[model samples]
Target: MQLFSTHKLRNIQAQEQAIKKHAILVVDDEVANRKVITSILQYEFIVLEASNGVEAIELVQKHPNPESISMVISDQRMPHMSGVELLSQLAKIIPKSVRIIVSGYTDVESFIGSINKANIYKFIIKPFERADFLWTIERALENFELQQKHDTHLLSLEYIVAERTKELADKNIELEQAYKKLEDISLTDPLTQLKNRRYLDKHIDAKVGLSLKAFQNWQKDTTNPLPHNEQLTFFMLDLDNFKSVNDTYGHEYGDEVLKSIKPLLETLFRSSDIFIRLGGEEFLIVVRDINQTDAQILAERLRKTIKQYVFVVNSYTNFSITCSIGYVQYPYITEQPNALSWQQVVKLTDKALYLAKNNGRDAWVGLSHLNNNINENEITKLLDPDEILTQNNTINLVSNITLTIK
Candidate 1:
C-alpha cells in the first residue's frame, strides 16, 4: 500500500509541475519590486517581468493564449497608463485574465476606483510583507487555473447539451411523421382515398356538440334578436342498385364504379360540407346553415348528377348508377327548448331516406313533414338503434337497394 501511494503521489506531483510551468506576467516600474515578486513566484510558476504598463500590455497581447499568461500583477501608479488602465484594456481583450493591483498609501483611493472600473480581482499594499505578497500571488494563480478549468467544463457541457437537444428534435419530427401516416391509414377509404365512416362519426359528433351548445346559448338569450337564418341539414345518400352492378359486373367493377363517383360527389359539395362513405354503397352528407328548400334542391341535384354519370369499366363496357337521398332540416324539428338532439336529427333524415327508397330507387325525400314528432327525449332516444330508424335501414345487409341522406 505504501509503495502504491508513493507512485500515485509522484504522478500527481508531475501533473502539477506541468501546470505550474504556465506563465505569469508581473508589471512594476520599480526594478527592485519586480525582482522581489519574480523571485517569490519563479519557484512555483514561470514568471515574466515588464518594466512599465506599456511593456506589460505588449507582453500580454503577444501571449494570446490564456494558458501562457494566467495572471497579471501591476503597480497602480506607473509612468504612462497606470496598472488599472492597462488592466481595463486587457479586461476587454482577454476577459478571463485575472488582474491584481499593487499600490502605496497615497494611491489607495485611485486604486479603489480602478478596482471597480477594471474589476481588479485583488490589491496589495506597498512595503508589503514578503510572505503576504508571495501568498497572494500563489492564491491568484490557483484561482486563475480553477477558472480556466471551470470554463472548459462549461463549454464541454454546452456542446453535449446542444447535441442531445438536436437528437431529441429529430426524434420528435420522426414521431410526428409516423403519427400522420397512421392518421391517413385510419381515416382513408382504401379503395377511393376518401374519408371513411369512422372519421365522419368522430368529426360529426364534435360539430354536433358545438352546434347544440351554441343553440342552447342562443335560446337562453331571448332579449337578443334571433339570426334571420339558422338551420342545419343532414343529407343521407345511397347508390341506386349498387349491388346489382356488383352482381352483373364483378366486384372489381363495382369498386371502380364507387371510385368514379367520389370525384363527382367531392365536386358537388363545398369544402365546408362533410361527406363520408358509411360502407358499401351508403354515404352521409352534413351541410351547415342551409334552409329546407336549398337542402332539397341540393339533394335533388346530387340524385340527378349520379343518374346521369356513367361508369365505364372497359372500352366496351358502360353502366350507369343512380342515388336515393333523404334530408332533415333542424330548428324546424321543434319549438321547445332542447327539443331536438343531433341523433334524432340524423334519425329523421334516415327516416326520410327510407321514404325516398320506399317511394322509388332514385329520388330525394324531405323530412320537414316529420318535424312534429321530434322532442328532446325522443330525439335523444333516436340515437338508440332500437328507437331510431327501423332496423331495415340501420342494419348492414348485402342487398340491392341504394340510399343516401345528409
Candidate 2:
C-alpha cells in the first residue's frame, strides 16, 4: 500500500507510455476474419496481421522489445496452428503481453481448459458485439500497463536501498578516521613532531601510580618493600635567547629551528628514551638506567651539534641556534625512609636548568637527587596529567650531587 512520490509517478508513467507504443498483432487464418479484427482495432491501436501461429511468432521475434506488441488477439481453430498455440508462443517471447482468443462456437472447449496453459487475458465469440469487443481490448491494455508499473516500482525500491546502505557505510569510515586523527593530535606536538606535554603527564602518572602502590605495601609490612635499583634521568633543555630569534627572523623561522632539532635529538638517544617539547623552545628528555655523567655527555653532544649545524629556514636565510641543558638523576630504592616522587624530581630539575641559564646562556648543569618526604597520596593525585605537568613552584627541595653540559 506504499504510494510513490510525484516525481517517481511521472517516471513510471513515462516508461509505461513507451511500453504501450508497440502495435497489437491480430492473428487469424481466414482473410475476412483477419481484416474484420484489424479494422475494429485500427481506430485505437496499430494492428498487425499474421495468418498462423508460426507467422505471428516470426513477427514477434522481429519486434522483440517488451514495449512492442503489448497484446495479441487471434481466432481459434486456425488452419496450421490454433489461437491457443500462438498465444503460448507469445507468452515465452513477450511474457507481459495480454493474450485473447476468439471463435465462432458458443461453447469453446479448447479455450475452456487451455486458459491457464496459454495464459489468455480474454476470449470473444465470432459473432461478437462491437461494444463488448472494444471493451475487452481496453481492459487487456490496462492490465498490461499495471503489470509494467508494478515491476518498475520493485526495481526502483531495490536501487534506493542499495544507495542508502552505501552512504551509511561511507559515513562510518569517515567517523573512524576522524577519531584516529584526534587521538594522534592529543599525544603529538604539531610543530616539532615530538611527544607533547599531555603524553608526558599521562606516562609520568602511570609510573608514579605503581610506585605509590608499592610505597603503601611497604608501610603495611616493614620487612617487604619495592626494589629501587632503576634510575631515571631528566634533561630539561631551554633554547638560549629563543625569543630574540623569533623577533629577528619571524615565528616561521623559529618554528623551522624547532622542527630541525628532532632528528639531531633522535640520533643521540635510544628508542626507549622519550623526547618532548613543552611549548615554545623548551624540551625534555627522559631516559632510563642513566646517571648524571652519561646524561650530561649526551646533553653536551646535542648542544655541540645544534651550535654547529646550520638551520635552514629557507634558501635565502640560514642561522645557528644553541640550547642550555640541566639534568637530574633520581633513583628509586626499596625501604627508603623518605622517598621523593618523580614529579618532585622534575620540579627540581627545572630549578637547576634556571641556574645554568643564569650562569651562562649555553652551558649545562646536573643535580644528583632531591631527597623527598614520601607522601603515599602523591601517586593517587598523579592521575591528572595536566596537574603533574604544571607543578607549582612552591615545593621545598633538599639537593645532592652536581655536573654541566658545555
Candidate 3:
C-alpha cells in the first residue's frame, strides 16, 4: 500500500509543476524574429506566438484564465499597431500582466516617454544577450505579483474601516433615543401625564425673564398701539371639592379625574404656554402674550369648562366637577416692572384663589395691577388682598362673579 501511494503522489507533483509554468506571448510582424525569441524561451516558458497587435489582443481575450498569460513581449516597430500602443490596450484588459518592448534601434530616450505611457515593465534593445533577456523577464513578473498583493491588502483595510464606522453610527443613534425617553419620564407627572413641579422649576425663570424683555421692548415703542398688560400672566387653579371624589370613590377614580384635565387644558390654551400639575388637584398655567381683559376671559372660560365636563371613571361611574381660579399679570406695577418678584406675585395669586373659594366655589378672581404710589408697607399688605383691597383701594380686582368683593 505504501509503494502504491508513493507512485500516485509522484504523478500529482508532475501535474502541479506543468500547471505552474509561466505563459509568455511574443508578438512580432516578422516570422524569423518570433522564431528566434521562441527558441530562446521555449525550454523554460510556454511561449505563445502572435503575428501582430490585433492577433495578440485576440489571443489574450480568448484565454480561459486571464492570470495564465503572465508576460507579453512585443517588438516596437510593427504593422497596424506599435508595441507601446498594443501594451496600452492590454493594460486595461489584464493590468496585472507584465509587459516588455523590444526595439531595433538603440535610441532609448526617443521612445522612453511612450514606454512609460504604456506602463511597459522594461525596454530592451535588439541583439540583446540571452542571459540579460531572461533576467529582465523574471524581474518584471516579480514586480507584477507585488502590486497585486498590495491592492488586495488595501481593499481589505478599507472594508474593515467602513464596517466599524457603520457600527459606531448605529450606537450613537440608540444612545440619543434612550436619553430622550429618560428625560421625558423625569419631567412628566405619571398620574396626569402633565408637566410636574420639576419641569416648572426648570423652565419658569427663563420664561419669566424672556417675557420681561418683551414687555420692556413694547414699553419703549410708544408708536406701538398695544396695551401694557401684554405680558406673562400666572393662573393658580384648584378643584372645588376634589377630596370628596377620593373619599366617595377610591384613589384610582381620582387619578382618572386628574388625567382628564390634560385634554381640557389643551383645548383652551396655546401650545407655547406652560401647564403644570402642582400635586393633588391644584394646577398652574403660565399664559403668554395676553392683556388683563383676555386673561380674565380665559380664566372664566376654564372655570365654566371644568364645571360642565363630565369625569368618566368607568361604565356607570360619571360625575361633574368645578374649579376656582385666580390670575395675576407679571410686573404688577407698570412703572416699577421689578417691584415684586415672581414668587411674591404667585403668593398674591394664591390669595386671590382663596377669595374666589370664599365668595363662591366656582369663580375666577384677577388682580389687574397695583397702584403706582403704594408704599413698601402697603405692598407687603397686598398678599392679604381682601382686607388691603377693601380698605385702601390700593389693588384693582377683576372677577367673573357678581358682588365677588370679599
Best model number under TM-score: 3
lDDT of each: 0.74, 0.73, 0.83
In candidate 2, list every pair of residues with a backbone clash: 228-332, 228-333, 364-405
lDDT sort, best first: 3, 1, 2
Question: Candidate 3, clashing residue pairs?
Answer: none
TM-score ranking of the models: 3, 1, 2
Scored against the true structure, residue 188 in model 2 reaches a CA lDDT of: 92
> Which residue segments of model 1 deviate by more than 4 Å?
1-23, 31-69, 103-118, 124-139, 213-229, 332-334, 369-406
What is the TM-score of candidate 2?
A: 0.52
Compute each candidate's TM-score over C-alphas: 0.75, 0.52, 0.77
Q: Higher-TM-score candidate among 1 and 2? A: 1
| Model 2 residue 19 lDDT score | 50
lDDT by residue for model 3 (129-223), tens: 98988778777767766776787888888888888888888888888888888888899998899999889888888878876776567669847
